[model samples]
Target: MNNLNTLIADYFKDSIYLLIENAIDIHNNAINKPNDIYLSGKLMAYVEVLSLLQMQAQAFSIPLESLKLDKFEAEKDLLSSRIISKEEIIKT
Candidate 1:
């Protein structure tokens, strides 16, 4: 049970990381190419990711208010600095 809890906690953490990374990537790309179709596409992708993350948090019983994007991104940045790559998430 302890192992399972640890795994789930890690999974939740990774999910938040991927969401922030993707959002940042999309935002950066959109800024670099503000005149192309890529801007809208990336923006939409980021929004969709936020929606999905919210749903996942709800499913995992995490409080919605506790999982706001700003808080999640800050937490992810700290967690990311300790981790090597996003590939670790695929293990679960």
Candidate 2:
């Protein structure tokens, strides 16, 4: 894989991991509601969609431009771990 391809690949892989982590966190928090509440149908659907998306992503790769349009990246901090961080634009 070339530089751009590698970047795009890393972006996709890291993105999926981030999505799962976020979903789990949100789901855990949601289930913590009072009165033994469960996850909403909408959130369940969202997880299903993410599952399908991951399955599809495993087989196919999209263009970097498309990923750029969505603007997600695995930025590393002092913790040195991959995470979906907001993009910062520096106007020069």
Candidate 3:
């Protein structure tokens, strides 16, 4: 049981980093060319990845409130800033 918990925790930790890097790439690309046609689509993809990251954190029993940990805060901040509007999340 302990090993399983550790494995799951490690997976989530790695996933968080991957998601963060992906988000940064998208953000940078969008910023580099304001007229880029794919900016919205790439950002939308990042938002989806962030939602998965959030779900994984919850599955591991980690509270969203604790995302402020020094190791996780930078990624969390980037993810938070790209949140899809509530209306978009709720759209059918």
Candidate 4:
């Protein structure tokens, strides 16, 4: 039973790391191609996924301080600034 519990914890930890890595890659792509709305949308989706994952991790008593969620939030904010609103697009 103890070994099973350890495996579960390790799985969640690995998942969190994988999610963070994917998010970073998406963020970089969004930064490089600011005009690509698809990449921006993908990044936003990753942010939401990470947020939910964080909540689930908390439920599992996983330590989140080392996750660097704040950095992802900052990256999201940066991408948001580059996004043009529908109104602006219409005006142009």
Candidate 5:
């Protein structure tokens, strides 16, 4: 039973990583285009999904530290900075 639980945890962790990667990709495209409402909406949806996943994981007592969410957050911050820079350029 312990081994089975480990397997299930590993599977969910892998799925979370995939979801995070997809969200990063969506964020990249959204930043590059800056005008595509659809991509922005999709990114928003991904964020919601990820949030729910994290909440569910916590509810199940899963250790979230292993998820490496900081990397995702750093990437998101970088992308957000690019968007801000572009907006500033456009405004100036």
Candidate 6:
């Protein structure tokens, strides 16, 4: 189940990025003047879709962030210990 959720989240993220790239490359290039080209209705719709996906992904990632924080703290502790021991050896 977790793997499926991760797969879905990754897919959503990829889709959102591709949609943004397409909007910038295709629609944004259609205008001769730089400021004249605006987001078309289709682009706006894609943005809305992206927003919804982002919200869902954030919700799903809350616990993942907590897990990452725990791992980072453990790594820091290990590095701190190693550094202290090396400094002590150098001093001796």
Q: State which candidate has the highest lDDT.
A: 5
- Candidates ranked by lDDT: 5, 4, 3, 1, 2, 6
lDDT by residue for model 4 (1-90), tens: 999988877786567556666666676668778799888899888877877766765787756654434334433443554542323212
Tens digit of per-residue lDDT, candidate 2, span 1-92: 69998898778767755664565444544555424335445446556656466445445674534433223222212112232223331111
Model 4 scores a C-alpha lDDT of 0.61
**After superposition, which runs of candidate 4 have C-alpha atoms over 4 Å from their true positions?**
58-62, 66-92
lDDT of 5 by residue, 28-57 (tens): 788888899998789888877876666766
Q: Which window of ten consecutive residues has the lowest lDDT sum in model 6? A: 83-92
Ranking by TM-score: 5, 4, 3, 1, 2, 6
Colliding residue pairs in candidate 4: none
Per-residue lDDT of candidate 3, residues 1-92 (tens digit) = 99998887678666655666666667656656667778857766776667666776679887765542223333344444354232222222
Candidate 3 yields a Cα-based lDDT of: 0.57
| TM agreement with the true structure for every prediction | 0.51, 0.46, 0.55, 0.62, 0.66, 0.39
Clashing pairs in 1: none
**Model 3 misplacement above 4 A:** 55-61, 65-92
lDDT of 6: 0.41
Q: What TM-score, to 2 decimals, does candidate 6 have?
A: 0.39
Candidate with better lDDT, 5 vs 6: 5
Quote the positional error of residue 83 for candidate 5 in Å: 7.6
Maximum-TM-score candidate = 5
- Candidate lDDT scores, in order, read 0.56, 0.45, 0.57, 0.61, 0.63, 0.41
